[model samples]
Target: MKLLLRLATSLLLWIIMMVILVLIILLPRDMEVKRIGVKDHMSYHFTWSGYKENIQQYLADVKENKTLGTSVAHQPVEWELAHYGKRSIAILVPALIISFLIGILKGVFDYRRNRGLWKVLGEGTTWLGQSIPDFFIIIILELIISLTIHRMFPHLQLYGIEHWYNIFLPILFLSMYPAAVIANYTTQALKEEDDQDYIRTARAKGLPETIILWKHVLRNCWSKILIHFMPIILTLLSSMVIVEYMTLYRGMGTRLMEAIKIKDTIASTDTILPIETPTVIGFSLEFMIILLLAQWVNQVIKHFLIPVRKDEHT
Candidate 1:
């Protein structure tokens, strides 16, 4: 019954996401450029024509299995999605790993200092940071760099987008909320476990704090802790898209945005390409698949661990 419910819920969420993506692609506030004079440009109010054309073109392409129209060269929609998806995976996987490590370690660190200082410093800091949304994090960091750091050291060398070191800032930024969430959960989980008879007995037996944490409290509480990773995966994945788009990183998000944006393909003829529907749908669907897979993995872990939890209690 629970399995059926979970499946149904997931399917519903997936459908809703697909609907939203299609709307964003098909029902946009469309616009075109007009010349006020030779060099000046004016924005024209949009019409339903742009929307109609996008849907018609998109359907025709789907029927014919046509190539994506956004790129300069002829490229299959599948190829564009695959290429950019791989690039996103390369950057995001590292961010995911780093986020997990930071969250787990920081959580453990906070758990160890669970009294006095932990309440004021650990709890306050973790919850506060976690409350702020992902986009704000990126904006805050960008502002810090632009307003303060860039002004302070006007000639300081900064890494370009493609530079290896450029990956670190996004990774670090992405790691923040996940880490804070994990840390917060870890502290609470450890606290709950600390009140257990086994943990109390171990403490009464004069065992060192480290041994009790690693061997006893954790052993009993690890299954519960595993559940937290489920949400963190989603958080990290979504944040990867946002961060990549905001920074114009060469990833799936950037590709999708670029395709959706209105651009003049030919200045001579003033030819405009409509939103790359195939490319947009392709990337959005690919991202949804990855998200579904992560959710499936999380469910699998819970499914396996539930029996162990029952046995332990029995």
Candidate 2:
């Protein structure tokens, strides 16, 4: 019941947010900014008497199957959004899954054997990962590839994402810092769970360390870790955007970069032209949907975790 309530609350919030986003995007810019070329067709913004009219027109567009309107590039916003969104997900989902697995295991290993060289390495790696900007990490990877791997392979293409595996590098770079955060959070949660009287009793019974760690310690710590899942996913989204833009991965980030580019006729002019309001809004709406999907997935995971927790003793 509580979980359902949380889902309901989140759904309500998402709807409110999307509505506000649409208003902001469709809101009129200064009439002074010159609308040119394909932009002349963007008559919706050039003339807006009131929000009610705009909302009604938007609904009409929906009914007429012109939902996404158009883009500055003179292409359908819906088609472009789907293309880039697909690219973004192709890289993002794999990276996120890899990071989660690596992070959880590393965190467990770090805390369970918290002594000597292994401890120092795990702590240092996580700290450095959080400290370093993802851009530099990608740059360093690029430099290494050019310096060594490309030279060694002679004709092999490592960048520009020609094949599915071409994005392997981007995925690795994207996974790094989010994994570090998860490791740190997991380690802390485990630490707190470790000190509990229940853990102490379990240890007192001469239970195998492996069993105590997995069956007892982790079962309790999971709820704490689950609480951080959304934040970690947010981190992944931000980093993936940066990585995609830098690497020119032809993903949503690249599309976003293109959408935001200033199309001003005079570079010195203070007037800010609308790059593609519909495109921008389309991009934003899709991104919001991704987050909504992530939230739903997290709730589902929690539902599954509940059963696992109950069955732990069995």
Give the alpha carbon lDDT tens digit for every residue of 101-203 in model 1. 7766677777776589776676777778889887887788888888887899886533336665666666766677787887777777777766767777878
Query: Residue by residue across 1-314, what tens digits does model 2's lDDT show?
Result: 87888888888899899989988776655434334765532222455575567678777876797567777667788989888888888889888888888888888987876788887888778778778987888788889888998899988775666876778877888898888888888898888775667777888999988998898788777877776778878898888778887776888877887886765453422343556777887898888988987897788778768677655544
Question: Clash totals for all models, in order?
Answer: 1, 0
lDDT of 1: 0.71
Residue 53 of model 2, lDDT score: 72
TM-scores vs. true structure, each candidate: 0.73, 0.83
Steric clash pairs (candidate 2): none
Give me candidate 2's TM-score against the actual structure. Answer: 0.83
Question: Which parts of model 2 are misplaced by more than 4 Å?
Answer: 31-60, 72-74, 264-272, 299-314
Best by TM-score: 2
Which 10-residue window in model 2 sums to the lowest lDDT?
38-47
